[model samples]
Target: MKSTVETLSPTRVRLAIEVPFVELEPSLKKAYREIAQQVQIPGFRRGRVPAAVIDQRVGRAAVINEAVQEAIPAQILAAVREHDVKMLGRPELETFPELEDGQPLKFTAEIDVRPEIALPDLSTLEISVDELQIADSEIDEQVKGLQERFATLKTVERPAQDGDYVQIDLAATVDGEEVPGGSATNISHEVGSKQLLPGLDEVLVSMSAGDANTFTSQLVGGDFAGRDADVSVSVRTVKEKQLPALDDEFAQLASEFDTLEELRNDLRERVTRVKKVEQLYAARDKALAELVRIADVPAPEGVVREEVDHRKQAMADQLERIGASLDEYLAAEEKTEEQIDTELAEAATEGVKIQLLLDTLADAEDVQVSDDEFGHEIMHRAQRAGVQPQQYYDQLVRAGNAGAVFGDVRRGKALALVMDRIKITDAAGNELNMDDLRGGSAEHDHDHDH
Candidate 1:
């Protein structure tokens, strides 16, 4: 087998491959044997038909077609590997010659490929991100949340009010017929939550126990979605909350802390850690955007368009699952269809450009994803997806998506390497460290080279 690559552009290529008779012999023999077992012969028993007899019955061209179909994928893979052509999207078969007797097989494929990108000098690259800020109010909010969780509920003999827990029997009807799955009895709800139905809060206010009222709302989901529903509610009980005072006793009851000051300090630390992680994510994205802006890289038009189409299809599918359409989404978001298209195009172009840049950098730095890293990634994703790790791995392998996962890990490592080399300063003029991403535990070594 022999293969050659033609540079169509920096981001595209044409692969011309030729397979000699010796290389094609195995596939040819297999194709002949498989076809012999399938096609019935007048005299010969099944699976015992000679090649000549099978050829005389089934055209020689049919056998060659079958063999070529079986041969092209392996041949294309070989050609791509031989030339080190990193293809992006699907390969387009440009030409395939009709095989003649004792002749070599020849074919050509055009593919979108990773362009040779010249990344900006990482050491010289500089970007500034927002300074870390954790407000006292944020910590107070966390403390308040904990207090709510430990608050005691008291049965009150009064009308419903905002912030009061109410137990109610509720049902929804459209045109005097009950909506499916829209009725509940003895449902406990916060009066002001408004989580169950819109306009429900307004009816519950000042309504005492045993009070019955009806309010109109538009259903957002189910068979009768978008239809106006008459929701009737009968309050069974109204309960008020007695929050534990923000003191040492409350702190001891709520957490492993003996004092309110210790609990507040812990919450502040947690909030700071969360904010720092957010800062880390923002820095990576901002840095990548800056690199895309400064680097000598051109987004492949074909790849960008393909990405745009894929995103649009995904969006459409998502809306379909929710019983919505593009028009409805547009109206809800107050965006025009053309605006949506523009946004998708912009996002797709940037995504492709960033991917190409990271892939090229990964190659330059010899970035690799180890088996242990891949396994960890699989386990993490499976946990998030609520599936077993082995099941996810098998699904990925079956879908030929294992390479994509490997590529993702390699690209992440490439970005982390860039993070190490680049200069990132906070708004306060202090050098921000990527080490802060791991909860500020700077004593541990990073996963990538410095």
Candidate 2:
């Protein structure tokens, strides 16, 4: 076998391969044997039919087609390995040479290859991370959130006010024509919550039970068109939320804590955990941005365009699932498809730059994921995503995205290692505790609910 490779672009290559007839003989013989077992011919028993007889029965074209189908993929893979190409996606096969008896086979394949990256100087980079001090107001807000979660709804016999819940039947019309997805009955909506739409809560305010009113307002974030909509709402009942008193009894009823102080302490710890996670994400983003800024290599334009197109297709799919077209969504958002494409293209370019930076760092640090670590990470993610471990693993493999998952974990590890070697300080100029940033011993456990 002989092969030649041509660099079409930074991220693409064209391969021309020529395999001698001798190299294809084994596959041809195997194809002939498989055909003989399935084919039937007069005066010849099945599985005992000679190759020439089977060829005569099935035709030479059929045998050659089968042979090519069986041989091409392996031949392509062998050629790729021989040439040491880092393929990013599937190759598009083209330009098949006509096969002649006892003649060599020739073909060409075009592939998208992974771009090579060079690492930048890590010592010269600097990143600023916000070091916010937990405030008393934040803790109080968290406690209030807990109280709201345990609040109860009580029916009231008066006009609805702000923060009151009203059960109503609603319908919208444009020029007295009923609109799709604009009618509902027995729906309980809270005034001042803004859960329904922006001016809907105000429309229901000060309305008593059994009051029916028609108002006009513009529909937001939906398929409805026009600048304004005519909405008819009838209040069936008014209700108020009665929050439980924040005391020892409430603490015991809501959680394992027996006292309000204990509950507040637990809430503080949970808030701290959440804030730490946010800080980690911020630091990661800063590090990646810095890396991209300092890296010298330019990202391949083809890869960025491909990523942008992928994002657009994904957005289209999401719109279809919600019974809306991309045009409608863009109009609702007060934007055009070209504007969206421009935004996505910029984002995709940044994403490609960041990926290349990470790959370079991984290579410099010799970062790798062990089998055990990969399994643990996959299982952990599956549990968090509320999926079975094996099912999520299969999905990652099928989408050709397992490398992405591994890349994330590898980049995270590499960043952590870089942090360890750097001089990190808080806003107050005090040395930061890297240990505090990386201190978590909890291993995720998988659970499936039926």
Candidate 3:
């Protein structure tokens, strides 16, 4: 087989392959034998038919077509290897015939190739990261939030007031016709909490138990939109929240802390950890932005196009999952597909640029993950994802995404090196600790929304 390559673009290539007749002859003979075994002739046994006889009966074109199908993929692979083309996805094949036996098998394949990238100067880049100090008031507020979580709801024999919880049955009608999704039975609603609707909370305040009231409001943003709704609600009971006493016993009951002071200390540490993580993220963002600004390298167009296409497909899939058509989603979001694509193109381009920049930095710095570091990182991610480490590893391997995990680690190490070289300071000009920022706490839910 002989091959030639042409550069279509910086990120695309075309390969022309020519296979000699002798190389394709074996496949042609195999095709003939298979056909003979499947068919019967007048003078020969079913399995004993000759290649010439089978070719005469089944046409040379059919045999050659079968042979071409089997040979094209291997030939393409060989040609790609010979040309030293680093391809991204599968190659598209187009074949043309050269006459019989001693003639060549000719085909052209178009493929996306990985672009050669150059490393940029990283030592000259600078970034500023803010240092945050945990405040006493913030710690107190977090403690109050925890106490609220342990609060009890108590029945009250009085009229329902603002901030009181009320159990009620509600129904709504518009133009004397009952509106869909405007009714609920035995639902507990907090007056002035704004849980149900905007104005409905105000209307529920100051009503006594067993009282029925009616009000009119406009429907908001869903299936009965743009119509006035007349609603009637009857209160069955009124209740108030009774918070737990802020004492040593209360702290012991709420958490592992034995005293209120201990709990407050823990909360203060948690707040510090959270602020540090936020600071680290902010610093990373600033550093990346600076790198992009300083790096003088062109991104591969193929990577940018692939990223844009993947993002569009993801958005389409998300809309489908949410029970909305692409058109409906675009209309609701006030954007057309083209408009979305245009908006995402810049971000996609930047993403490819950043990837190439980081990869180059990793190479320049000789950043690498040791086996221990890789294991630790994988286990840490698995713990955060609530899965076994081996399970997550197996999943990454199966999906062919194991390289992605290593890429993330390498990028992180590269950023750390960049951070070390640059001077990070707060707005007040004090030095900040990157390690403190890196070792921050994860978020925990104190309420359903949190």
Q: Taking the tens digit of each residue's C-alpha lDDT, what string does model 1 give over 121-143?
A: 89998878898888888888999
lDDT for each residue of candidate 2 in 179-222, tens digit (9 for 90 to 100) = 78889999988888877755677778888899998888787535
How many steric clashes does model 3 contain? Answer: 0
Query: Tens digits of per-residue lDDT for model 3 on 1-450?
Result: 999999987667899888988899878877777777888999999889987887788777788877877788888889888878877656776545444655788878888776666554555655666658777889879988998899888888877788788999989888888888788999988788777855677677777789898887877645766688888989988899888999999999999999999999988888877887777667766877777776554666767787888888887888878877776667668898888889878878877777667777788778889888778778877887799999999998999988878877777667667767765777677777766666732322100010
Q: Against the correct fold, how does model 2 do in TM-score?
A: 0.74
Clashes of each: 0, 0, 0
When 1 and 2 are scored with TM-score, the better candidate is 1
Kindly report which residue stretches of model 1 are placed more than 4 angstroms away from their true locations once superposed. 1-5, 16-26, 95-107, 300-348, 368-371, 382-398, 440-450
lDDT agreement with native, every candidate = 0.85, 0.77, 0.77
Q: Which residue pairs show collisions in model 3?
A: none
lDDT over C-alpha atoms for residue 79 of model 2: 86
Candidate 3 achieves a global lDDT of 0.77
Which ranges of candidate 3 are over 4 A from the true structure?
Answer: 4-10, 14-73, 90-110, 133-137, 157-162, 171-183, 197-199, 214-231, 242-265, 312-346, 365-399, 403-416, 441-450
